[model samples]
Target: MRLFIAIELPDGLKRAFAGLRTPIPGARWVPPEQIHLTLAFLGEVEETAVGHLHDELSRIRIPSFKLRPAGTGCFPGRQRARVLWVGLEPEPHLRDLAAAVQSVLLACGIPQEERPFSPHITLARLKLPAPREVGLFLSGEPKHAFPLVPVREFILFQSRLSSAGAQHVPLHSFPLT
Candidate 1:
């Protein structure tokens, strides 16, 4: 199965994120329910391996923490803006949580990501750079767009790919104290 780990957002925040959508020519906004802060993306795993993955994930004991949207930016740089995203206010606890999850994945024989963890919620998939729309969107959004989002749990999600795009289904949830 194609799987990953991430923090789900609250309904109000999802609605607020949806409200940020604009009519940019080559951009597709992420659906409200699909928005999440990804911790690790595990491309594929054997059915038998899932049990071990879930067991390792449950062993994580990070405390819950609050985070908020700080601003917006593009992936692979703005000059080649392929993804538009809302940056999260960095929390050490959040980073530690991600690290713990990664450690578990590595222990389970999952390949490790060479890149460092940079937390952000993807807002749209962009086919081309929409600089004008991006600037307007940034200026319109307050420095801190949403209220503090309490992240009490992270889930191991199964991603089913289809013509309609990817749909995430929670396979198991790991709670934070």
Candidate 2:
């Protein structure tokens, strides 16, 4: 199964981001329901190994913390932006939690993510190289500061890709104490 671990966004925050979707040509906006802060992406794991993964993840212990969206940016740098996203304020606890998740998954024989952990919610996928308008939008000061929301739990999700875009199914949730 195609799997990943992420923290689900609160309803209020989801609604707030939903309103930020402007009509940018050649960009595909992510649906609010699918918005999440991913900790790790484990691609194509065997069914039998899922049980081990679940067991290890259930033992994760971290204190709950609050997070808020800060500014807008894109992947592969602003000049060659491909994925538009909203940046999250750097929280040490958040990074710790993500590291713990990666450690456990690695012990379970899953390949580690080569890229450094960058916490952001993908807003849209640009079809062509990012246009001047996208740069302009991000250049402005953040129009909104998302309300701080509690992070009480993280979930393991199964991703099924289709023509309609990826469908994320929550398989299990791990609570933060």
Candidate 3:
């Protein structure tokens, strides 16, 4: 099964992002329901391993923290961009939560990512759209400063790729105290 661990966004934020998607011409916007801040992407794992992964997740202890979506940015240096995302503030607690989740994946024999983690909620994937337009859109600041919201849970999601886009299913959820 294809899986990953992430922090789901609240409904209001999802709606806000959805509104942004309506106008973008060629970019493939992820379904609002699938919008999440992925901490780690565990590409494929044996179905049987899910149980053990859940156990490791259950043992994770992290205190809830507020998350503020600060800015807009793109990945791969924006020269040949692939992903458009909303940048997150450097919240120590959020980083700690991500680290805890990473530890669980490592303990489960999952390979660790060598790249340093940069927390962001992917808004869209650049495909047919002119990358230049994305730069123009990002040239101006976002109208609002989404206030910090408390994050209390991390979810294990299964990604199903389709013609439309990737559909995510929640396999399990673990609460942070």
Candidate 4:
């Protein structure tokens, strides 16, 4: 199955992000339901590996912690941006949880990710024919600062790619306790 681990955002935050979806042209906005901060992307794992992954993840114990979305930015350089995201505030618990997840995935014989973990909420994915007006829109975008919310659980999500956008379904949930 096509799977990944992530922390889902509450509706309030989702709506807040959805509000900013406009103005940026040629960018595919993420559906509110699929707005989540991914911890790891485990592409196309075997059905049998699911059980092993679950068992390993079940041992990860992290206390609930607050996360606040900070400034906006684009990945892979601003000029050649592929993804736009809201940066995350530095939270110790978040780092710990990420490290623990990485360790668990490694113990399950999953290949280590070469890129360092940088937490952020993906807002949109840009297409090649990005609108010329995008530079002005993104430049004048207003700042956003919202109340921090506690994340109590992380989920394993299955992604089914279709002609439209991808559909994310929560396959399993691991609580932070």
Candidate 5:
């Protein structure tokens, strides 16, 4: 089964995310319901090991915190962009939470992600040669600041891939207290 751990956004806030979408050729916009800040992406895992993953994750006890979308940018490099995203304000506690989650995954014998954690909400998937405006779009600050939202919990999501796009389903939830 394909799995990942992430902080899902509230319904109203997700609608606000949808409001930011713009028409860009070859760019695929993510549905508002699928918008989330991923903490860890555990590619594909055996069905039997999922139980251990859940057990270890439940032990995590971090205080809930808030986050806000700050600006827009593209992944890899704007010169060769593939994924467009909205950056979040720097929050030490958010980083701590991600680290704790990663630590547990490692203890559970799951291999660590090669890339360091950089939290952001992906807005679109771009196909190269990406439109020239992708770089231009990210050049300035966002016209307005998105409201702050609480992060009371995170969920272990199962990603179902299909011809259309990936659909995420929450399998288990871990609360912060």
Candidate 6:
């Protein structure tokens, strides 16, 4: 199954992001319910290995922490942007939690992501490279200051791909103290 580990956003944050959706041509905004901060993207794995993955995840122990949606940016640089995302404030605890999870998953035989962990909530994907106006939009300082989001748990999610985009299913949840 195609899997990933992520932190679910609170309803209030989702509602706030929903209002930020603008009419950017060729950009497909993510549905609020589907918004999440991915810690690791574990591509397809054998179904039989799921139990082992879950076991490793259950061992994670970290204190709950607060995060705020800080700014907006894009992937592969703005010049060739394909994804637009909302950045999260850099919290050491957040990085440590992600590192712990990735470490365990690697020990479970999952391939490690070469890219460094970047904490962000994807807002949309552009069919083509982002336009000049999109760049301008990201250039401005974030007008909205999202409330501190208390992250108490991270989830192991199963992603099912379809013509309608990907549907994420929470297979298991591991809580932080």
lDDT of each: 0.89, 0.88, 0.83, 0.84, 0.88, 0.89
User: Ten residues in a row with the worst lDDT in model 1?
Assistant: 136-145
Name model 3 segments beyond 4 Å from true: 22-25, 128-131
TM-scores, all models, native as reference: 0.94, 0.95, 0.91, 0.92, 0.94, 0.95
lDDT of 3 by residue, 72-147 (tens): 8888855567788888888998898889888988899988789988999888887654666777757754675786
Candidate 6 CA-lDDT value: 0.89
Once model 4 is optimally superposed onto the true structure by TM-score, how far is the C-alpha of residue 176 displaced, in angstroms?
0.7
Which RMSD does model 2 reach against the true structure?
A: 1.2
Q: Could you give candidate 1's per-residue lDDT for residues 1-177 as a string of tens digits?
A: 999999999999989888888788889889899999999999988989999999988989999999988887778875667788899887999999999998998899999789999999999988888778776776766744589999899999999999999899999999998
Candidate 5 per-residue C-alpha lDDT over 1-177 given as tens digits, one digit per residue, 9 for 90 to 100: 999999999898788778777767788889998999999999899999999999999999899999988998889887778898888999888998999999999998888889999999998888874657785677644575788989999999999999988899999999998
lDDT of 3: 0.83
In the range 32-121, model 2's lDDT, one tens digit per residue, is 999889899999999899999999999989999999789988888776778989889998889989999999988999998899999999
Higher-lDDT candidate of 1 and 4: 1
**lDDT, residue 25, model 6:** 75
Q: Which ten residues in a row have the lowest lDDT in candidate 6?
A: 133-142
Better of 3 and 4 by lDDT: 4
Task: Output the TM-score of candidate 3.
Answer: 0.91
Scanning candidate 3 in windows of ten residues, the lowest lDDT window is 17-26
User: What clash pairs does model 1 have?
Assistant: none
Question: Where in model 6 is the C-alpha error above 4 Å?
Answer: none
Residue 146, candidate 3: C-alpha displacement in angstroms: 1.1
For candidate 4, the clash count comes to 0
lDDT of 1: 0.89
The clash numbers for all candidates, in the given order, read 0, 0, 0, 0, 0, 0
